[model samples]
Target: MKIALFATCIVDAMYPEVAQATVTILRRLGHEIVFPSGQTCCGQMHINSGKFAQAEPVIAAHARAFSDTDWDVAVAPAASCVASLGHQQPMVARRMGNDALAAEAADIAGQTYELSQLLTDVLGITDAAADLGSYFPHRVTYHPSCHGMRLLRLGDRQSDLLRSVEGIDYVDLPLADACCGFGGTFSVKNPEVSSAMLADKIRTVHSTGAEVCTGGDASCLLHMGGGLSRFQRTGSFEGTPDVTAVHVRQTSSTDVGDDNVDHLTAVVGADDDDHLTPGEKGTSPAEPSRIQSGFRVGQSAVHLARILASTKEDPLRVQSEGATVSGGSLR
Candidate 1:
């Protein structure tokens, strides 16, 4: 398949390595990649900040860029951006009263996808370790960012892909659905709340005992990594600014996600519990866990009526930044 790479602004500036990794993984799989040099921001940062006005031109740019390109599928390493395209872009255009542009944006979104989504759903890559030459020989925990989880409704896709990776010891990310506090411009606008959330996240990540925190969204990683900085002993920059903010990094356990160590081996203390966002679906969470009760497609929505009724009357609050389409999995 011919793929158009969505080098999200964050990846272009800070974590090109992620784009490179994405490219390597795809090419090794024998897919052709096209770099649409005209591509720019996906307008997520603007739209998420409530700057929908400023987001107009960005969305148009994206529409024109991709519309001009002829590729089998457009793939992005960032889930948030892909979610914005697939889900938020139409709202952006319609809100601006650009019905024509809104239609165009929606069309583009329909054709684009998050990397793992394309791999697992379209390409039939169910086992990463078995297929992708992927080898991260370290104890790693996966954080499914809010947008990817809620907006894109991508559950288990990222985790399943990681689990398929060779040499990867995939441990369950305690409170995996909890926000990493990177809500686009949300962190800058509401710094305090963002910090509080990040602190809670740091605590959970540290408790996981995983050496690395990996996720598809760069925004969340940046927030968590920044908070980890203040606690760094020397206070030296851990990675490049964009690197610190975009690419996944080693979160400091000194304050949040770290438990401790017996010299070389790091460890998360016991007392593991399931604390997914106040509400949202979980991939068979750690037991005694609460979830968004209704299934989407695969299974019959047995209590669908009650779940819909309750959520409508008292909108179940979700702590995470995402939610997937109902019942798309069980099918």
Candidate 2:
């Protein structure tokens, strides 16, 4: 099959490895891969921030970029970006009064697929280890991005592929469907709420005791990895007390101010371990034991494409120590 790769802005600029991995996997599957060089941001950020006017050209460029390129199908590693192709592009073009561009946008959206959707649905890849020679012998957990889960309705396609990886101890993340709080500009405009949501996610990830947190979207993983990195350094969330566990919950109908509206409450200094039995101190009994911190010193965020692209011959290195977070990049 001939495939055009839609390397999203984040993957193209910040994490080219992920794009390369998408190419690698396709090439490995005996498919031809082509890059549409004119591709830029899918205008998700603009559309998400209510800048529809700014998104018109972006959506037009994306439609033109892929339309000009000859391929049977287009695939992107980022589910959010792919979701935008179908969900927002046409609407944005129509709103701009460019019916021609809107038609083009709709056509392009139909041809685009998230990497896992292409792999599992189009290619019929049930076993990653067998079909793609995917091998990653490490403890890992997956976070399903919101766009992938809610918009794309890509249930189990990503995680199913991960579970098929050879020697991969795939652990089911608690509240796996929860958003990582990196909703593009949503995190920027609402930093406090984002941080609080991130804290809960990081704590859940810590409980999994996985060496790496993998996800389809680089943005969410980046958000999570940064939070985990900070926790690894300071051993606690910012302004959070040094407690065994901090439970953040929403108010229930029985006791709270308003019944309809929910409120976030942080119960600090709770003994999370007190309820566990003698042997279940760190382990969840159903899954692995909790690691000392959210993630180990060198634990890092990795894209799903990179993990799927991994093979026994040239395995992707998993860092074990001396990890650092700088300039909002997690390493």
lDDT (Cα, tens digit) per residue for candidate 1, span 87-140 = 788998999999999999888788888888888888898876567655555455
Q: What is the TM-score of each candidate against the true structure?
A: 0.70, 0.83
The lDDT of model 2 is 0.81
Q: For model 1, how many clashes?
A: 19
- Residue 259 of model 2, lDDT score: 55
Q: Put down candidate 2 lDDT per residue, 107-163, tens digits, no spaces.
A: 989989999999999999999999999999989989999999999999999999999
- Candidate 2: list runs displaced more than 4 Å: 240-295, 321-331
Q: Lowest-scoring 10 consecutive residues by lDDT in candidate 1?
A: 295-304
Report, for every candidate in turn, its global Cα lDDT versus the true structure. Answer: 0.62, 0.81
What lDDT does model 1 reach? Answer: 0.62
